[model samples]
Target: MQSAIPVSSVWRRPVSPLHCRCEEGDLDLVVIGAGYQGLSTALHAARAGLSVQVIEAGGIGDGASGVNGGQVIPGLKQDPETLLALFGDEAGRRLIEFSAGTADFVFDLIAREGLDVEHTRSGWIQAAHTETAMQAAVQRNRQWRAQGADVALLNPAEIALLTGAEGYRGGFLDRRAGVVNPLALVHELARIATEAGAALLLNDAATSLQREGTFWQVSTRSGRSFRARKVLVATNAYSEGLVPNLARSLVWLHSFQIATEPLPPDFDFILPSGQAVSDSRRIVLYYRRSADGRLVFGGRAPMRVPQSTDDWLHLERAMRRLFPMLGSMRIEQRWFGRVAMTPDYMPHLHEPQPGLLMAAGCQGRGIGLMVALGGVLARYLAEGSREALPLPISPLVPIPLHRFRRLGVAAHLAWYRLLDGLER
Candidate 1:
């Protein structure tokens, strides 16, 4: 309802070059990758009085963190019931509670840091694409409500009223969910982390990691090296040969999104609540309106980086199918990013060995969860208490026949599309 903060002010801020006086021995932590996880962990670790340094192959937020759909939904990619089934009652209950509070944690961080990212806590809608899906939404509403979540099922009438579209049979709404300028948030986090006495090294790709005496030695492509007591590999899907068996442990898929030009002045009653919407399809369709009134529509794409606007044509078609009025809208921007997926569709925290920690496989819900996990990691590093973590530490389980993962992912995508078409 209110105009967003000037994007130029947030997105155009310059990143200062890395000036590290700590050399190698004095560094307490060396975090790889400068996306949400790395920045969040750096911020919390620095706040806890650790000498932290973050190394990014590209600029900050140059990974999925910058190009995400920006929907701040709680919980993991797997639903509550599934979590309970995967983990037992106690662990699953803890995870469910943590998931429920993810949005609150993110919003509070944004406020405490005085971040200018366009944050809106209007709500989020999990639209049901089929009758069976709507029934499942009811079940989810009941499950989460029983677990103390403020969620509700919306019938078709309410769905139409909320989304301004008749394609969805029904949906579930979570009031805690919202959206933000993801890139802006990333920049602000990096800024605050550095301001609180952390070093950020951009264009410094980690070339090799080794154990040198008591500290972990991390060598960079720029020929600089840092040795720290602890090392965290937070590079999710973009981890190209940085860590052994890291990229192979999860399925990497491409997600593309396109933004429309600002709607006409007369346009109204379309997502008037200003909430984000995601539907119940294996290859899901998610969208939300930008602060400037452009509808940002996004969904799954082929497993390749998009080269031009034409690569987003399928996304545009998907948007038109949901809201025919958008058929004639002009496309203003197109982009794609890789998202990681675990076998169980849950974010994994791995401790392959002591002094080495890795967190990845956000499975498309990384915005809030990554921030919260960062805090958990900080606590673990500071207090050395793994029992206090919401997520249990597990060994990295690399996918079988890892080299054929691309072909496997393609087949899975085709199967999901077939299933979605049948439901429609």
Candidate 2:
């Protein structure tokens, strides 16, 4: 007998969130935040035979890592030539190599770990919204291909046929990229991390960090104090007071998504290629097909949480504009998550105090980058070497006038929208 209540496509077995402490004195590492970076770090550290622990403020899948649209895109906001010019020959080449392989790295890990996250490495699209955008895509495809990446160019006809969307001039596709069940990935990581001897404490926020003798002491909201030889602070746009203005350093923006219930069988042609897409617009449009055949569409949202339906009307309009076959599909889910964007659109590694390390700035490309970074971080932590890290360690510098970012972001979004219209 079918139950009256509808079940979600992705099955959930929530982790038992309880207050737990590390095992005994002077642990090797105490990680704050249980997002991809923290989980990856703990898993790798534990596998390496290091004593480690994780402290999460909320339940798993509460941050950007879990709630995202699951697009595993590789590369940074900068192109190869620009990166080379900015950071010279050696460093730029290293950064390029690291960014290019993030997606493959993530897919390999999923297979290697036997993670239950449903995923594919079919490809990822960068739809060109304008002729100029097409030219840029062409250049990007050429650059990556020359570096031995499996990338290709698509014509207007190919773009329209592949995406089932209107008004795309051309595009680029990276065959190494793909999509995943984001929350499922996080849950599996948590499960495996705990099984590997990394203690995970959920709902226990790290409220304070201070040095106690040689070890760094982390004080939690539950009045529990943990001491460790090192600390990893994973920044996911929700960081705050624990580390002195760490939150202000990022430009936090909201990216929201709406998903339809499993569509009728005939709608399979909508994204028949089974590749996730993000277009080349100032305010980008990204969408994908879920494992259960729902259309999971997403785009720029208000800087804050939605207070009314008006905040999401733009997505519906855009969806209908792209794929007009559906007159009125009922949206089964509407959700949003905060993204920490850097002004330069590059990832940063910081060491604010002795024995404390942190990473910031995902810029909407967090999925694969953050996961791949885990091995980098784990190796660095285990062996005490900085040679493999892409970004140099630096002090956390707050973004200037972060208090006024609300007004600036709102105004800029409006202006960018107007500019997008003018381009057409």
Candidate 3:
């Protein structure tokens, strides 16, 4: 299918360095992947007066960054309490503060860059499908408010009024959360980075890397090489086997989305609140109303491996179950993407090798976390401080039974689907 938006109109050409030609000996930094993380890092480094270059195997935002659910939800996928238990109070608070600042950072960046990506702060609703889930939602809202967040608990009647659906028992609303045209945001960031004097190379894939004394020589498939003092692997899920040690450490899960055609204006009453919504299931279903009044829904579907043509009948069924008002609406688009997940479900930055840094394993919270991580990486590069980073940099450890990841993911999906059905 053709892109809804033109590619050329979305991304601009990168700016070539004037003083240092392409044949110059080395650059200050070479970022792999043109997704949000890489582009943000390139922008930050170039803004810091460093010669930076970004290489992407495909077009900008061709990966998960562009194809996600587009719900700019706050906090990590795993609960903040779980994080505290795992890393102790101090580190956990640092992680929570960094993550919670993600939404603020995104809104601030849009304002600062003047990007027209259709960003809105209409808020997000975390609904409960069961009584236990409802209690969890209320508790989460209370905890977030205690931590100084602007959040409110919605009773059953409030939920019905906000969602126009009787399925949700209760929920909470966070006005700081919102949605965006993710592809548009990525494209705007790429443009802003280029305008800020950063070089971004599309269709240039990093094939291999070698440490050249105090510098790094990164080779690309297009018979090109970049010599940089430091290299950041912000490839995320599309790392393409570059770092075998890292590839084995994380579990990549496939998440799929389906967007319906813009509904009639009469249907606006169904989602008058314009709040993005998500449930608390293990394989949760998250959805939001688009600026043009389309319902974009997404969730984890049963999949043995990552493939474009995997059947989406399950997602369609789920959509019908949640909002039967659009049962007859045609699906305008369906897409899938893989998100890097850690056992602890937290994003991590790894110093796999000195001078060569890797930051990924964002789970499903990559959008905001990636931006925050980029800013942190920029600060770390500018100053000799890892303290600026939101998440801790730890040693890479391969997921157990790495070779059977596909089977493991399939089993996990089946179990979650079964659990969702049982709960219903």
Candidate 4:
């Protein structure tokens, strides 16, 4: 296994600051947020001959796009059968096909861009935490297999061999899924977008957005204004209050992860096949072996932004439960990222107003979904074809009483944790 470059260190990797005029001007698209979606959309849109400008409140990928678990898991939380049943044929099939190809699209982009980074496509394992979960995996396997996905069910013995964890009963693997240093990919995407002629305004946040005449005028906190024909709010989980329509559309949660100090022998024991492993618990825990020989272990975290490392120690108990040998290992990295969840556990594309597009809720699979969706958005914007979109542009209704969402999520996580513990 290759060594994973320290994720924290990547934050300091010198991406040249935008040397050109930082002024806001006429543009085809003014994308808010420089995470995966914004960078990808900006890259594609610029290539498609659209004048693009991206505004970021902080450094690129400073949000979940860089800090996430980096597991390139595919599809929505819903299984193929459920998707078909819930969405019906046309929309369901489109969703299924779009999701199935997300992982491929991400890896393809990495390759096409000639990104020199450590990545693997060995597979992704959904290690079942209980017999019921194993049964669920079996059904998912059957459904996805029937849909021509390269998937298979793994028995307990196979699960142990693959995950190197003891508690999992069994699970299934998706060969199409994998892992990569997300920060590497996203930071590189920023470079690619810049090279493609997209203006990147780092450390600048969009404050207000309004329609004036034919163009949308986006005012930044730094007193810069950009007029664009279209706008995309790709902030995802980090959507604070720049636009209430997008900020209130989804629920936000935090996912924290800890990395062991270059556990090489542990890597030999855990996830030797290079497959990222995530359990089937409702409050799911996911782990992957980084190229730097670190085991990135993570699950649910505080519903709100963590105050410090004290907020992350809660995971040690669960970590030792799965791999008790880790009980004595030194944790070198502790971090958490924001997660956006929709009520339906599916991604949403909202057109709250004309020429203003919003995308949210990849339900933790944003890496692959956003990467692919970027191209789709680019094509759609380039051709003005709404019918070609796999996702429907639905109405923007703010989740009711979103101010109390944190308390509600904390309660739900507690209940789910109790239920998950009972199964164990």
- Give TM per candidate: 0.94, 0.95, 0.92, 0.94
* Worst ten in a row by lDDT for model 1: 1-10
Q: Which candidate, 3 or 4, would have the higher lDDT against the true structure?
A: 4
- Pitting candidate 1 against candidate 4, the one with the higher TM-score is 4
Cα lDDT of model 1 by residue, 1-424, tens digit: 0112211112233344334333445588999988889989999999999989898988776788887888898877767888889898999988988888888889999998788688799989999998888898888888888877778889889999888876889999988899988988888888888888888888778999898887888999978889898999999888777677888888888887888888876566789989899999989999988888888888998886555557678788788888887669888777767888888788888877778888988866799999888898987877789776888998877889999888888899899989998887
Off by over 4 Å in 3: 1-23, 304-310
Which candidate comes out best when scored by lDDT?
Answer: 2
lDDT of each: 0.83, 0.84, 0.78, 0.84
Model 4, C-alpha of 240: deviation from truth (Å): 2.6
Model 3 scores a TM of: 0.92
TM-score winner between candidates 1 and 2: 2
Alpha carbon lDDT at 52, candidate 2: 93
Cα-based lDDT at residue 274, candidate 1:
93
lDDT score for residue 359 of model 2: 90
Per-model clash counts, in order, read 0, 0, 0, 5
- List model 2 lDDT by residue over 274-315, tens digit each: 999998889888999988888988888778677665677899
lDDT of 3 by residue, 167-262 (tens): 778898988888777877788778877877877788768999999898999998988988998889987777668876788877777777777888
